[model samples]
Target: MPTIRKKGEGQYHVQIRKRGYPTQTKTFTKEVDAKRWATIIESEMERGVFVSRTEAEATLVKDVLQRFASEVLPTKRSEQSDKSRIKTLIEEFGNYRLASLNSTQIAKFRDQRLKVVGPQSVIHEINLLNRVLKTASMDWGIALPGGLPTEQVRKPIKPRGRDRRVAELEIAKILEATESLELRTIVTLAVETGMRRNEIASLVWDEIDLKNQTAHLPKTKTDVPRTVPLSRAAVKALNAFGVKEDGRVFALQAESMSQAFERACEPHRANIVGARFHDLRHEATSRLFEKGLNVMEVAAITGHKTLDMLKRYTHLRAEDLAKKIG
Candidate 1:
């Protein structure tokens, strides 16, 4: 039914030739292991359910990831972040063959990553891995006999969303600490319009319509275009810069803005506690709710794709809520 021969020292080669199925061959260190593999292949062939594992068995996880990076990563909005995750995945499971990848291995990776990073970060990495495997099977024509291992693995529990709202006094201290007009303006816009740091940093003068009280965002984190309603205060802040119809609204890039914010917050660490620049967004979202804006109205202004995400950014004060109820 099959042929097994000693190819070299500690090398046993097995070949199976079925009448209706294609020839299959593999090499193992032991004779018994080679025989066991042959039996499985022959049995699959007998049942007319044999799918060649040669390609999947031969391909490495890193090889597929590299291909995905070159071909697919460019088309994605989160290309930069995805690239980082891909690098980590390759570092961890690069040498493993696709056929050898299992749920246990993925589960171990989840547990290991949770030690160094938060659940959300690990979730992104695992989801990326799952996407790569699916692409390998569907687009690259690599067949996985056992289906996707990632599908069987349980993802780490997502942690609760941050509810850190920036207080008025802390905001005042931050604005006073940073004399940079650009940084002050960025902070002001973040609280006024609930615009993300990147969105504010990347905004050009043409995107703003002061007369119409709106700012059109051509690109956002969700890859969706949004028009944000500007308050009177937001308009006044923009007017402070004067007319520059062609350039970015802010002088700093996203990372530079974050660094500058951190530096500004250094002196007021005790007063601010855990206040991050992003808390301005939370503060803005909560204020919108406190002003009697409905869910749809707030979502439209904030560019939040889901009510759940919008809720994460909103942390209304109970005292204010009680006033409304009374």
Candidate 2:
């Protein structure tokens, strides 16, 4: 049973108590509404499906996201990227109360986001939102409207894998435009070894073994340490760039390097409209295949966990294959 008392100004306070459950309380503007809520809550308790909605109803999405950003994001490996996506979510739904969050609203957000960004970006954002809601429901004891709304929302189609190999002429233009020796060397290493830009930029001198012709990465995006066998070109680039015994290989930040690459690509933008710094990885992977290396061999170099992932990067041209056929 719920104890109902009239608080001044037509407000009624109701508190429901049951065995083996914490007392739940709420204030209603109407006495009838108070009685109605108590009946529903007591019945739910009897059926063992009751959840306290006080926190969820009182807290806004902005507060939950802020708390997540401060407490949870810092512990993540992809913290920078996670923070960026969480910030975007906050900007969109910060004012919404947690209790009011629902599938229809989330679907509207997804549809709207798809107009401006790619499907992958929207997917990442929605996934984070789902994570936050789950945490609130399970850990914070916040009652959600139902199961995660992300399940009901339609996700955009996954985009096709990019196969934009850098053409010789485009490569020439990029190299020519790249006056910085550091950026030049990074670009060369990416094409020659098929290593990601961050992997190349973050390399330390100790990770490189010029004598053994291998670079040992202690950590990579795949969360595995992979020793990339250095090609003759890779070794030559490393030698020309020079190395210190126990320091970073390149004195560059990943974002700055990416920006520099983008600027270098500007001159040949008309020819390479969709080219990105990452396309160099694709180019290098395809080149490895052209050199007659099998899928397993390429996977070893690229640190692809599976052959399916490696195949996405390997885009061999028909003309090249036709010549080999003849």
Question: What digit string (tens of lDDT, one per residue) describes model 1 on residues 1-326?
Answer: 99999987999989899787778889999998998898888888889888889999999999999999999999877899999999999999999999999999999999999999999999999999999999999998999877899999999888998898888888888888887878777888899999988888879988889999999999888889999999998888888856587877778988898788888888554245677888889999999998889999999889999988997888989999888899
State how far residue 9 of model 1 sits from its true place (Å).
8.6
lDDT (0 to 1) per candidate: 0.89, 0.86
Lowest lDDT sum, 10 consecutive residues, model 2, at: 265-274
Q: Residues 244-279, candidate 2, lDDT per residue (tens digit)?
A: 789898888887888888888775542446678999
lDDT of 2: 0.86
Model 1 stretches astray by more than 4 angstroms: 1-31, 38-51, 268-271
Candidate 2 global TM-score:
0.82
